[model samples]
Every structure is written in C-alpha cells, then in structure tokens.
Target: MTTTVIAGKYVLGMREGRQALLQDHYVYVDGTRIEAVTRDAPAAGQAVIRYEQGLVMPGFVNLHAHCLRGGLFRGIPDDLEMDPWVPKLVYHILLPLTGIAAKELTPGELHAVTALGMIDLLRGGTTTLVDMWHHGQEMFFDVAKEVGLRTVGAPFIMSASNSRLGEDGNPVWDYGNDGLAQLAKSVALFKARDEGHAGLAQVAIGPHATDTCLPELLRECRRAADDLGCLLTTHFAQTPQELALLRSRYGMSASEYARDTGLLGRNVILAHAGCSTDEDLKVLADTGTHVANCAFGFAREGQNFPYARFARAGVSTGIGTDSHGMDLIGELRVTGLLSKQFFHQAHTGTAHELMRAAT
Candidate 1:
C-alpha cells in the first residue's frame, strides 16, 4: 500500500493518559488507516506533505443532529418557550413543510440541501454525525457517501402522535397502527444501507420522542435494536411540555417510562434530557444510557440541559449541535461555559472535560 507522511507544526492528541500537544509531529497514513503519529521525521523514501502552521487533532463526533431539515427551519421559530413553540412552530408549521419538502423536492434539490448541511459539518471539523429526520434515508446516505463523512442515519418513526396541532391549538395524537410498518421499513433500510456501505454509513432506529411513541412501539423498538445489534435513539425529556404530557398520559416521568418500557440501555443514545429530573438521571445512570447534550438549541429557548449533573451521575454524555448549528467547536465552547454558569462553579466544567465530551 502507498504511504504518505503528514507533518504539521503542532499535533493535538492523547499521550500518556492526558491531552498532549506535540510540536513538529509527523503522522503516517498507509492507504485508509493511520500507521503512526510521532515527532520523528518519516523515512527517507516516504512521500511527505508539510504544514508550516496548523493544529492537527481527531475529528469531532456529533452524537445528535438533523441534517435534512436543519438549515430549512432556521429563524422561523425564535424566542418562544416549548409550550407555544411545539404547537405553533413545530407541529403546525415545520411538520407539514418537512413532509411536503421531502416528497416535492427534486433529487438535485434534496441533494443540494443535504450537501449544504454536510459541508457545514465538515467545515466545523465533524468527521462523524448521527442524524434523525423524517423521510429520505437513502438520499441522506447518498449525501454522506458523497461528502465522505461517517454518518449514522436514523429514519424517524412516529406512532401514537404525529406532532400536529389540533383545532384547539394543542398537540394531537393519532394512535393508529403504531407505525409498525414504518419501523419495519426503517429496519430494512438499516440492513440494506448499513450492510452495503462498507462501514462509512450506519443506521439506528429513531422513535421520535417519548410523547410521540406508544409504549408498545417503544418496547418493540428496543427489542428490534437488540435483535439487530444497532443503536436506538430518541428525544427524552426535551421540554417541560413533554414532561407534563408523559406524566398526564402515562403517570410516569420520561426516564421512568423509558426504563419501564425497556428503552434505556447502553445501546440507546438519548438526546436533550434537559427536562429530566434527578430520578430520571438515576435511571439513565443505572441503565448505562448515553446522553447527547446539545446546549445551543435549548439555550435559545431560555433553558439549559443538566449536563454537569449527568457527568456527576456517571451517565455517559456527549456534545451535539441538535441541528441548531453545525459548528462543533462553538458547541463545545458553549457547553463548557453554560455548564459552568449553570452550576455556579468554574471547576465543574473544565475545558478538558468538555473536549472529552465532544470527541
């Protein structure tokens, strides 16, 4: 195999159980794999590309995102809390638009929008993105392949509720066949793309949210994920309205319902546990469920996630943009600052800890 040496002024990586910044380091790449990274010069006959002034580090892994509709719904729903926001902006406005756009947009248009999001992700140094969206899984896989980024696409599956505003301006529930066909289609899509994509792409089951899916559906999704040996992700306790809905409907907290329904596990990655309680956090910790903390999106609505609490509770936490922005560096900075401010202790969220979450 052909080998190449990339020499940079500074290399930022791990060494001896700590973060290290090495000066004048050379990284050796043999075809697709990294052979070595060291301060010594490459062999005499090896091809070398030198960067006089740059920092090289591992790429960011965005644990939660929605690429297809991320750029499309910007600026329309601003400065609103979850109560009015969900009914008016999300259910009434964005949901219908998403369905229409998914069907009506031509292939080129779909590719263009998806490519724009992926480019923004790459420009912000994100090498891997886990995205959940409605419709167009194949198109998203195609875009990820074209952009040469590792991606996990989870096609959205909704059962009891479709997130539509009723005549009374409240969120409505459909409660039909529990979206079993959609789940099956998603599993089939996972096998089709994940098995054929040469490891560049993967698939996960997305059940939308706790308030949207039925109990039976959630249980079946967990079983399917275990059977397929893939990840299962959902939005958990994202908003106060969601918490209220869960309490009223199921007489249980979001995390309680999830745990009882067999949804909490190591393979499950939950997004936006901002409204989760201490009990919910305990459930997450005990079950080894991973939390994807996206600070910017929730902060816009005048809220903050319990990231520091999650860290302290021994819950595996990672940073994400949540489709609000693609800049992982900015998200990392915001996560550190917001977490510190929320806890009123600067040492609670150190730069190193935040960097660890991002990576």
Candidate 2:
C-alpha cells in the first residue's frame, strides 16, 4: 500500500498527558493504521492531503443503537409520550411491520435500508457502533464489513414473554419457551461472524430487557458471554412500567435483579438505565458495570439518565444514539446539558467527561 500524509490546520486530539488542540499537525498513515502524528510536515516524496482549516479528531463511537429500526422508522408516530407511545406505535404498528419486512423484503432491499442507517452513522463521523435489533443481523454484518466500520452486532434475545399494553391500559404478556434457542443462535452468530473478522466486526449477547427475559435466561446469557469471551448487554430500567413490573415479579429493582442473576459485571453494558435509583447506581458502581446513556430518545419522553451521578459514583458511562436518528454528535451535546440539569449545577458533567463517553 502507498503511504499518505494528512495535514490539518487544527487537530483536536490527545497530546502529552491530556486533551489538547494541536495546530499545524500532520498525520502519517500507512494502510489501515495511523503511523504517526506530528507538528512537522512530512519528508519529501510522500503522498499528502491537506485540510487547510479543519478540526481533525477521532471518529465517535455510539455505544448503543438499533440500526434497522432507525432506518425503517424515522418519522412515524412523531409526537407521543412514552407510555402510550410504545404500545401504540412501536409494539402494535412498527414491530409487526418489521416482521413482515423480514419475510417480504428482498435481500437487496433489506440490505439497502440497513446500509442507509450505517451510512448515516458514518456520514455523521461515527466510526464504531454497537447495534441490537431483530432479524437480518447477518445482513447487518455484511453491510458493516462493506462500509469499513467497526461494529458489534448484538441480536435481540426475547424469550420469556412479549408484553404490550392492552385496551385497558395494562400489560398483556404472551409467554413462550424460546430462550434456549435464542441463546444458541447468539452463540452461533458470534462463532460464525465474530471469530475471524479481524476485529472489524464483533458480536455480543443482547438479552432484550428485564421485562422480556426471565431470570434463568439472563443467567444463561451471562454464562454464554463468559464462555464466548464477548460483552453482554441488555436494556435495563428504561421505564417506570418496567421498574414496577420487575419489582412486582422479582421483588427487586432492575439493577438488583441483574446483580442477583450474575449479569452485572465489567463486561456488561446496560442501555438506558434512566430509572436506576440511587441504590441501583451504587450497586452498578460497585460491580464496575458500564451504562450507555441514550439521552435524546429519553429526553423526547421528558426523562433523562442520572449520568452525572453515575460518573461521580465511579460508573463508566458511554453515549449511545439508541433509536434517535443516529446523530451521535447531537447525543453528546444533549448528554452534557442534561447532566448539568440533573445535578442542578454547572460544569457538573464537563464537556471533557461527555466526550470521553462518546469516544
């Protein structure tokens, strides 16, 4: 491969010991890896590309996202709150259409929609993302490889039940016994797609959420993650209804249930966590579990994560676009602002801290 040098007027990157905005820096690239970054220009006879006045920085990482859903359902059911919003828009209308799309859409058509989402992420300067969705995950992997983005594909695992609000404004669950099969499918996906992908693609276990997965199923997911040597992630404590249901069913908070099931660990990534109580945050901090804060989606419902408190409690927090149009840049800004509002203090969640979460 030919060597290339890229020069920028300003480079926002790490220098010496901390974050620094460098001036007149040139990056030396050879094939896939960056050879070096320096203030001095490259020696004579090297291919060079110069950005006269641009801020060059590392690409963002979206810690949680749903790519297919983001692409297929961007502007439907726009103005609604969380409670009626989920059942009426998501479970009733969108989810069934997803199933139909899986069966009806051609491979080319499916890949096109999925690729549009990935392209949106890349165009927005996101170089890596962790995506969880149902159906056509293998197609998602193919698109990731083609697009040259580092992706962790997690297939959604929902085994115990599919719960949605009935006409009476209460949950109606349709139970099933497909947990073991889904776990097997997840492991097989990891072995087939993740093992020999040269680190460009990876796989993780995504047990849908506490409300959808039984305790035994979650425990098995933990063991599978350990055995497969990959990350285990799930949706936890995202809504008041979920919290109430978990407490009623298991007699514990969502975080407590996760801890008891051996699901809280260094390798575990919990998405949302908007409803995690103070005690739950302590348990998360104690166990070294990470949280993916998808602020934009929740903020639409007039809610926000306790990200500042989580950061102060020593919990590693990262930014995720979740289902919010794949605008990681916007998510970062919202995360920083929401943290300050949640803590009722300025600079409580500094820009540096939120940037660390995204990258």
Candidate 3:
C-alpha cells in the first residue's frame, strides 16, 4: 500500500487517554488505515501533503443524517417560531414533501441528488456518515461505494402510519406499516452493497420514529439487528408532541419506550433526544444507549439540543448534522454554544469535548 504523509500545522491526536491538540504534526496513512500521528519525519521520497497553515484531524463520523433531504432543502430558513409542545415539521413539512420528491424524481435523478449530499459531507470533512432514508432506496449505497466514503445506510423500516397533517392542523397517523417486510429489503441491500469496501460500508436497521412505528415493529428491528450483527437507529423524543403521544399510548417516555421495545443498547443510536425528560436521561444512561444530537436542525426551529444535557446524564453522546446541514465542523460551534447556554456555564462545552463528540 502507498504511504501518504500529511503534515499539518495543527492536529488533533491522543495523549494520556485524552484528546490533545498537536502542533506541526505528521499524520501517516497506509492506504486506508492511519499509521501514525507524530512529528517524526517520513521516509525519504514518500508522498507528503504538507499544509503550511491547516488543521488536520480525524475524519468526522456523523451519527445521524439525511443527506439527500438536507441537500434538497439546503438553505430554506425555517424561521417560524416552533411551539415546543408540538411535533412540528417532520410530518407536516419534512417527511411528506421529501417523500414526494423521492417518488417524483427518476432513479438516476435521485442518485444525483444523493451524490450532491455526499459531496457536501466530504467537503465538510466527514469520512463516515450514518444516514437513514426511505426503504427501497438502495441506490444511496451505490453512491457511497462509488465515492469510497465510509457509510452506514439505514433503510427505514416503518409500520405504515400513513402520517399526515389533519384538517385541524394537528399531525395524524396510525399503526399500518409492515416493518418486517421493509427490514427484509434493508438486509438484502446490505448483502448486495455493504461488502467489498473493506468494511467501510454497513447497513443499519432504521426505524423511522416512535410515532410512525409500532412498538412491535421496533422490537422486531432490535431482534433483526442482533441476529445480523448490525447497527440500529431511530428518532426518539424529537418533539414534545411525540413524548405526549407515547405517554398516552404506552405510558412511557421515548427512552422508557426504547427500553421496553429492546431498542436501547450500545449498538443502537437514537437521534434527537432533545425533548427527553430527566427520567428519560436516566433510562438512557442506565441502558448504555448512545444519543445522536442533531442540534442545528432543532435550532432552526427555535429548539436547542444541548449536548451537555446528554453528556452530563452520563449518556455517550455524539454529534450529527441531521437535515439542517451536513457540515459537522460548523455544527460543532452551534452545539457548543447551545450547550453552554443550556448549562449556564462557560466551561461546560470545551473545545476538546466538542471535537471529541464530532469524531
């Protein structure tokens, strides 16, 4: 394998079990694997990419994302003040409209759109991205392989709620989808496309959300993920309405609902626990489930998902750009600022902590 040496003015590396920012460092790569990060000079004649004034660090792993959706609705500012008590846009604006766009565009056209999202991800310094999309959209994987970007494609498994905004402007849905059938399709896509990239690609079981999926569906997805030895992800506590709906239907918060549904575990990534209660955080921490905080998306709607809230709860927290933007680096600033404000402490979200969350 070819050895490429990247010399950066500033680099993030490990030291004494903590993140350390190293200066004038050389990062050596042997093809796909990182060989080392040091100031040592590489062997003579090695291909060296020297950055005189640059920050070189680990490529980010975005824990939750919707690349195509983010790209399609890139700069539309959602300035409408959101009622914190409502499950605002996923049903009314985001999902239904994206579904229409996905169905209307030709497969090739959709692939181009997907490519556009990936390009944004690459430009934003994301090496690995965990993205969930509607079922049967296997071409998303095709784009990942073509670009050589590490990817976790979570094809959605939803029990059809036939979600829509009611005449009175409230979100409406019912338990009507066959999630197992969709799981089969995701598995098939995994088998067909997730190999041959030296494990750079994977397929995670993505249940859309608690409101859109039945509890039985979530339970079965956990079982399938276990049997297949893959990752599983879903939206949890995205809005106050979802929490109220779950409480009314299941007598539990989304975190409690996850525990009951067998969806809380290390291999699981639950997105947007922004609306979670203190008790919910306790449940999440106790279960060792990781939370993917996509704060920028909620921030646009006047909601802030403070990273400190989850991190302080002892929940393993990571950063994701979600549908607002694919720039993980930019999202870090927003996440840190929100975290500080949420905790009312300037030291709550240190630079190291924020960078650690991104990686």
User: Listing every candidate in turn, what is its Cα RMSD in Å to the true structure after a full C-alpha superposition?
Assistant: 2.4, 2.6, 2.1
Candidate 1 vs candidate 3: the TM-score winner is 3
Cα error, residue 71 of model 2, in Å, equals: 1.8
* lDDT winner between candidates 1 and 2: 1
Better of 2 and 3 by lDDT: 3
Candidate 3 structure quality by residue, lDDT tens digits, 1-359: 88889988898899888998899989989987999998898888777899889889888999999988877878764775656656556776788768887789899888988898888888889999999888757788779878767999897777762566566444555545566788788777767766634687788889888877788888888988888888889998887777777888889877778889987988999998888889889888988899999888888888788999999999999999898777888899989999999889999987889888888
Candidate 1 TM-score to native: 0.92
On TM-score, who's better, 2 or 3? Answer: 3
The digit string of per-residue lDDT tens for model 2 on 1-359 reads: 77788888887678776777789998877887888788877778766788898777788888999887788778753566446324354456555666777788898988988888899999888998898877354788889889878999888877642555567443454666687888889898988889533588899998978867778888999999999889999988877777887788789887779888877989999997877887898889899999988887777666677568678878888888876587887777778888889888887878777777787
Show where candidate 3 strays beyond 4 Å: 166-176, 196-198
Q: Is candidate 1 or candidate 2 better by TM-score?
A: 1
Clash pairs, candidate 1, are: none
**What lDDT is reached at residue 152 by model 2?**
90
lDDT score, candidate 3, position 8: 81
**CA lDDT of each candidate?**
0.80, 0.79, 0.83
Ranking by TM-score: 3, 1, 2
lDDT of 3 at 211: 78
Judge candidate 2 at residue 253 and give its lDDT.
Answer: 85
